[model samples]
Target: MLSSVLRSLQSLTTHNNEHQECATPGSSTARDPRKQVLMSSTTFSGAGPSVGKRLNIDGDIPDPSHQLPALPSNLPPPNATYEHSTPPQIPKYINAYSLFLAGSIEMGAAITWQRHMAQFLHHLPLTICNPRRGHWDPDSRPQPSDANFRTQVEWELEALSNASVICFFFDVNTKSPVTMMELGLWAHSGKVIVCCGEGFWKGGNVKLVCERYGIPCVNDFAELVVEAKRMLKQKGLDAVTDEEIQRDEEWAKGIVARKARKEA
Candidate 1:
């Protein structure tokens, strides 16, 4: 009976050992090479305590406060400052040279009118359109040369497009067919049109045309110049100053003196 009891006790001990081995994490299965390496390294290195135990070294971990303080429901209003600044004045000669001069080229009055206008507005640039010359042709091939009329008209239109202003010098005595067309084009393009002529010859048609198109017409070239200067000033270009006028007068006198000397 003692021998049987000893054998039974040994068998129970062996079964417990097998059970423990099966319960252990890696012992029952074929261990991964990497996992085995890691375990062996940990054992040899005598690694510190598990992370959980290390983190809670002092006492039980405290839970965060259940009730969080409420944030402000309304944000503070923004503080902003705005500044208003004045605009700079326009330059004196803005778009001065880029002007188109249209009129009756055949008439002497038209020439005189154009010359006066040009002289008065010397500071501004001017391009005269002569329909009689026809268009600008470098080859110069075409009969009657008048065929080039369309070419001149095209050139004038191009100049008009580039111009800041279009001044029409109309003569009531010699009503130019082309002048009306040019004026109409200028009006349609919203160009500033300044018409100049004498009152002796009835300007009813011209006056009516200007009235219909809302163009400014003046009898005197000097008055036209004044008006043009005022218009330019309003647009912030060429503000009239007494000093500038005086300077211009002095310059004119010098030119006259030179001319007189040359003539003598």
Candidate 2:
């Protein structure tokens, strides 16, 4: 999409340059002011009721009613030939190394994982996709049949499939039944990094599964952070910050609760 947009832009620029060149001394288009009009802000006809009002210059003046088409530019130089750069080392520009955060919510293990992501891997270009990190509700446990739950599951699955790696951290608190189920689902795929701390109910099974699948498994939080960073670096992506992922009120509440639990 970016490449196409760039190509269109290049074509348009070349066209405009030629148009400008044509109007150098004397040409039929020299008298045309439309060619000279560089679109800077929302242009109003100033013909009717809204004539007195100042049109907004922000963000191309959103025209919701009609779709704006790309303006045609003048033709390029007759001798100018197309040039392509040598193939990029990487396929394309990935915003970040997307690592889907999976596993444990007990005692806010997910929050701990998020913090580690910030403390250690924060400098790296990566995005941790953990739905439970901020959306956990203390008042009510949502059922699997709930629309939100189902939708979150769908989104997580999609992120898992698309992510560079699946980082699973098992807290010693809950059984992490859903996490285990997800482990099974993604077991065959080689995109998992399992971390099962001591006393986790399913630690043994998780390890065994990791061994069977030849996936990298760790037992410490620091180890998990290191491994996740290694994986992201190998993908050759730039480090992105938390500013990209906006935490909502619910997520903020979860963070507060996690902090309070730690303080207690």
Candidate 3:
């Protein structure tokens, strides 16, 4: 279904002559719903409304007082660090490496492996570009023309392009066609680390591509994390202060204490 929707969107871009003059020939924004420039805020909370909200098509000026708030700094650093379509309470950090989590979303049906990855690497200075929506309704069937869907695709593309490292995890439980497509897109970019489980339907194909491209491919999730860390360190981008690790430890302890109190 995703592949079909992508095809339809591409077809529209190819045949729609109305906005040809305004769009860049091969730019990512060429397939925009409005076929015009898209302006997004650089801040974590975003400059405009959250995903699923209407985009500002008109050239109306935003009110100065109606500033989008930044995510707070007290929330767990790992929780606050990752990028999602919607804003939630999270801490603020800078000089972070961007790691695009590209694989096996499966419309929220796939296990929340991204969170696990985030937790394991919580102490590292990384901004996780997670594509999974904070709030998604599995029942709703979004069309190719849906604003939310377009926004999400654009967001993921931009994130992947900007990421320092892109990690792909092909879950055995999912067909993961989109993940396969993403792997193909970045395989030659020399910035990918893949974890294709033994039972994945496309494991053989993935292995062949990884071999051809000399991309790091691991059969286990744990190995992927290790490779990611090694890559970051080799690039001299894995600088994590002792303060950050201590902070994360304190946060974990607080979480455990809160859970214990609630249970008692």
Candidate 4:
């Protein structure tokens, strides 16, 4: 009778362990899918069934504070601009000639002119030389001895010299002392073009100067861009900039990768 009772107790224990291993279908434990381990029993060696990869609810690793957004499928990878990227190519003038916007800050009137250039002549994006981009201006400009000032001056000088066509804007509200200086420097070169508004403080002087030098002058800003496009047709896409060349390289790489994928 003792042996038979022992067998009955063993059977009941086995059933209890099985019930604990797999939860009931409608139990609270079954509500979360992540809660299910489904691992098998271990041997005496302390080894058990292999564990699967760790679950990633969002499939992205995050920093302590924030997670970066995943890149969208449809967009092309971003291109790195080589504007200031070095080793600087030897500055041989290639198809780099453009409508060099050589002028003073003049309350950022160049921005409005740039938009018009984009709208009217989408293909030809004029090269702009805005010296004030990286630094702030004082009421008094930086001295010629300053290294940064010298670098900007060199860049502007190069732009003015190499440009096939240049369109200058002398805004009414801005006396643009620098703009007037540049006008004299480039006026006789025949590549210079000018736009001085009606109310410009020195409009008469600018117009008279342009007339004397035979530099094309217009009263309207939009006319300046229109004239640039007309001149660009005569002057084909000159040597492209370093940034444009880098973008082309990136595009070529993408094409090659796509072709390789297809072959694979």
Most lDDT-accurate candidate: 3
Write out the backbone clash pairs for model 1: 96-125, 97-125, 135-151, 135-152
The Cα error of candidate 2 at residue 150, in Å, is 2.3
* Candidate 3 runs further than 4 Å off: 1-93, 137-143, 240-264
Q: Lowest-scoring 10 consecutive residues by lDDT in candidate 4?
A: 38-47
lDDT of 3 by residue, 1-264 (tens): 324434533444444334445567467544322223112111111112234542211112222221112222553455344443222222132435677778765434355567666666665556777775465332223344655555666777877887778988876665565677677778889888988866775577788888888889976565566667666665567364445445544644554455448659
* Per-candidate TM-score against the hidden true structure: 0.43, 0.49, 0.57, 0.49
Residue 4 lDDT in candidate 3: 41
lDDT of each: 0.40, 0.47, 0.56, 0.46
Candidate 4 backbone collisions, by pair = 94-239, 95-238, 95-239, 96-238, 96-239
Q: Write the per-residue lDDT of candidate 4 for residues 93-205, one digit (tens) a residue.
A: 33254556665343232223433333333333344333323222222124466554455566667766766777687545444655666677777787787777676656776
Question: Which segments of model 1 are wrong by more than 4 Å?
Answer: 1-97, 107-109, 124-148, 196-202, 239-264
Model 4 spans with C-alpha error above 4 angstroms:
1-96, 107-122, 125-141, 236-264
Ranking by TM-score: 3, 2, 4, 1
